[model samples]
Target: MSLNTIDIVVFIAYVLGLIGVAIYVSREKAGHEKDANDYFLAGNSLPWWAVGASLIAANISAEQIIGMSGSGFKIGLAIASYEWMAAITLMIIGKYCLPIFLEKKIYTMPQFLEQRFDSRVRVTMAVFWLGVYVLVNLTAILWLGALAINTITGVDLMAGMIFLGLFSVAYSLYGGLKAVAFTDIIQVVLLIFGGLFLSYTALDLIGQGNGIVAGFAALTDQAPEKFDMILAKDHPHYIDLPGLSVLVGGMWIMNLSYWGFNQYIIQRTLAAKSLEEGQKGIAFAAFLKLLMPVIVVLPGIAAVILLPELERADQAYPQLMNLMPVGLKGLVFAALVAAIVSSLASMTNSIATIFTMDLYKSDAKPRSEQHYVTVGRIVSFSALVIAMLVAKPLLGQFDQAFQYIQEFTGFFTPGIVVLFISGMFWKKTTANAGLAAAIGSFVLSIVFKYAWPTLPFMDRVGIVFLSCLAIAVVVSLFENKVQDNAVDLDGVSFKTTAGFNVSTVAVIAILIAFYSAWW
Candidate 1:
């Protein structure tokens, strides 16, 4: 669909504004002579509010907006399970996990492993995450975003892909985590507004006379098969076996490893000024997580009813956007850009952080802040180039994107999380045990993924995670305890006013439940 002049202008204006923010932030970073800690970790000074917004912005991107909506249109409301379950996972992290990281004062997830386990394990896991973060996760999103833009506009796919890569690279290279967090605040706002608009517009098209429940009923009647939650046992298209394997057996393992351990998400908690702030931020993100189904998933379901002849599920969001009146169309496009850029910037900054702290500064003589910042720019530029090249090959396929990127993360995350929990709480979990858990889990997941492709992706992840948990438990039990190096979690304060604000959480929870019921 070709956009009108106003739509084009609005898109250009929004992009320019983001570029301006990036340039302004870079100047600030330059002025305040910053250290590696300040550049890489945002000085551990981001308040709870910023942390909350940034986390949501980073987490909700083209994957959720484009990929998620596509899944919803094809599979019905079951896809919303991903967003809702995240709330429960965040609560677990805030209550049980944040205290340990805050107390230990670790920068990267790998660093935490080093202290809990050994250097060999830390390096192994570090290399693994670095590869996944850059190659699989970031690359897929970048390509998908470019594909959407190319489909919507007349721009060349390769050129659009390169342009986006450069834009994300420049800002992330210069502003570090501070820029990523601040800009993400704007992104989250735009994304929420854009999504609500699409939902409202779609419902309006269905007819202003009907309430949300009636609107959904109308859609379901028009396309009864799309609303089918249980894939027929004998149906060839039914993924019941895979779905059952993925949903029951694998999802928990994946979520636990991700929300519980991943560095990109956890880095926000690490940057918090205090444990209270971290917990507050996590809880806030949890509340926002509940809204995703309405904004991203419901719209997809609406698309199925509204445009029954549409060939591709991934085309749903853009097609809906094309139907919007002029002003609304621009805003939605801007929000999509915001979502994509926030994720890109977050990944770029994290890659630089891992390189600077985990790889560069660990052994080399400590360099000046200016020198480190220079290296950061070079590293970001280099990574962006690699991601861009990878994005070209990632276009068109949605199922492959999810499985290829997510399944492998399970192996390392479960093992790392198990070790971290044991390291903090149990006195018997030695460094050797942590190392063993990580190595064992990594090898086991690879075996599971290739050896048993029919076993459902999520179930395999669950098996690997559980296996790691068991190995960590057994190994830690047998390993010798450190005589004097044992960590003390006693001094860490959990009584602060940082716990989940029940009222706010309750409101968000109610809204999510109401929407799900209506759907």
Candidate 2:
């Protein structure tokens, strides 16, 4: 792949524009004190639109753009269950989980655990999350983004990683969550527009310059086998996405843990101005979720039809970009960059928030608000450096980086979800039970991975979640039932505005229609 002068100019302009936005947003406003809330939570002032766009921007990274498209090339439309299921998951979390989290006034997910269980559980989980973010999530995003850039522009992979890190840190470290969230609005637009353009072009090329509908028809007619939303037991990739199980089984565990409990994904919702706004924003994000497969997944399906001889599935995305005209290639490249940098900023901000609020503030004595904010910036910068250093080498270990990410993260999700769900609604859940379940879930994950290697990862996750939930229940039965000290939700109204209700209904209706048509 090569870039012309027009492409180079567009790419440079995009980078400069992002830098300008970051500096502008991070500038100190008069009378607005720089404190923990202001820095970490955006002063709890993010309105519905920013929250919704930032949530989508933060969630869709190179993982989706590069990795998921790879999966689409390899496994077809079934892979999109991750995105489609997440729409329902977000609605469920917004309806049931957000009220409790907001009422507790908690800054981090681990902090909520501390309130519901004990300090030991909080610290243990916090450390676990920090490791996953730095070692797995952040590293994966950087590595994949660097791979894409290197493939398209011929830049060295390490140089690409460093450049991305500096660009993300430039604004995020100073402006904090506010800057990250607000700038995400633009990032989301670029990502959507560029992604759509790429998909359209890929389809048009496949369809011999016909419209998208004809291109899509050609795709299905040429590779009819690729359109299945559910897979058969004997299908080559069935282990990854088994039929019926995807609809009713372990996929739910994955979706719930990610959408409801993940720190980076939910942090924007936590920063919303009010519960009503947050719920509405989440509903809007659910609507956007419906369109992701069109942008991210369709191009890969088209790739399978157009570039069938490519050796690697991961090359599907960059190979498609190679076909775009010079100016459009630059625009699409900027979109991919936007996806990578926005996610990097969001993760950096989140890691900083969790460490500063959950660990440092509690472990050390309380200091001035400004002091904590300073520490957050330092943590953000350090985490980025560590991730950049490890990303390339760590990602080299896997043949398919996307599947590797899902399976590795699967090790922790079952336990975390079991802990949160049981602790939230079940008043009898004891701290001892929470601690035991957490430790037991990790052990079970290892046992399943090594001892029963043939078992599907999704099935393993489902089994672990149930086993841990049972253990918690059995242990609680033996111990004295703890009094309910969960966050009081009496003051937080579950009543959503009419717009939110209608939008949510529309999202659900669309999801049902999609599955019905595709399945």
Candidate 3:
């Protein structure tokens, strides 16, 4: 799987060009400097397209490209539910959630909790978010990306990981979210083009008669079992997909957590110039999400026909690159790197935001905006360093990185969702209940995890979500009737634009058509 000179040359050029673009977009006018608002939230001035592009660029990274492709090889198209479901989740957030957050003028998710509940809840979740971003999210992205680079170019895995970490810092640390957001548009274009080509190459160029159509036909005919949209209870992979739960159950919790609440992900939407801009950005991302399976998942399913007997499912994507021709192969590899580095930058940038805004700002005395921005840079760099050191050690052993991410993250998502629901809608919900929901979500999940091991985690998540909500509700009722901090939605309309409505219907129709055909 050696890369040709052209492939190497193209990837290098893309990296350099991306860095230049980031620097250019991030420059402040003379006598103005990068301040906290400017650095962290792009000064609240991103356009819809940039926000949309940044959202996808920050998301469809090494995990989706490499890890989920591995799942496609192992679990088939059933794996695409995560992406498909997310389109719906993004719409829900845009219509119902983003307006509130934007109206509140918040920078981070933890900050929202602070405003809605208390500093106790904010600090509790801030610590949890920082840990997850660094330990799980950052480490997984780096290690899995390094593994893919190793597979394609024979680059040493550790060396590849280090290069990726440094590469992200080179572009994003200086400019913060503005640089990351603007440059992400290019990364996404590459990701989509490269991913689609790789899938096509796997089907058409790898000795299949005719082209991609023929290759796809071969996959469906030869491996009909791989095309199921939902797993059966008796299916070997049922524990992973867990039948209908991928649609009607825990998968929603997962999507809501990632799209609506996660600081690292929602940070892009929070940076929009206005509520309308953010929702439009979300609508744009929803359309892109509908296309993601074609780019990311299909390649793995294609691998089942093209390269069936691999040691690991995760290897399916990188190994498929070995089948591609020279110049195009480099383009695809660059695309892969684009996803990895974009996410790395986005994650580190987010880690800095939460640390600086929720933790540092709350504790430290008032300081110059430049001082906080400097601290943010230092924190971002430190997060990258910490993640690089711990990545392989924490994530090296997992064969299918995507499922590991879902399973581990599942532990806390149900509880977080409960807290948010209570904070926003339930007037009687107390800070104690919010704090209790936070702890109770984890404790109950642990109980379900070990005590009821056979419960499919997707099901487990749904049950735990209900359980946590109940716990929070009961606790809230016992303490008080509607707390003063509950959100006042008097004039806040959840009504969306007609354009957004049309987009939502289109997405829903497409999802319906997709599931029906596959089912």
Leading candidate by TM-score = 3
Q: TM-score of every model?
A: 0.90, 0.97, 0.99
- Ranking according to lDDT, highest score first: 3, 2, 1
In model 2, where do residues sit more than 4 Å from their true spots? 489-492
C-alpha-based local distance difference test score of model 3: 0.91
Q: For model 3, where is the 10-residue window of minimal lDDT?
A: 200-209
RMSD of 3: 1.1
Model 1, span 67-132: residue lDDT tens: 778777777666666676677678778877788878888888888777766677677777877898
Our model 2 lands, by Cα RMSD against the true structure, at 1.4
Candidate 2 has its poorest 10 consecutive residues by lDDT at 482-491
Best-performing candidate as measured by lDDT: 3
Q: lDDT for every model? A: 0.74, 0.88, 0.91
Error of 1 at 458 (Å): 2.0
Q: Model 2, 1-519: lDDT tens per residue?
A: 678889989988998888788779777778766899988889899999999999999989988889999999999999989899888888889989998888888789998999988888889999999999999999999998988888898899899999899989876789999999999988999999999999999888877888888888899999988899988888899989978778888999999998999999899998999998899889889989889998888888889988999777887898899899989899999999899999999999999989988889954466989999999999999999999898878896565688889998888888888889988878788888888888888899999989998888898889999999999989888997655665455655677678877877887888788789889
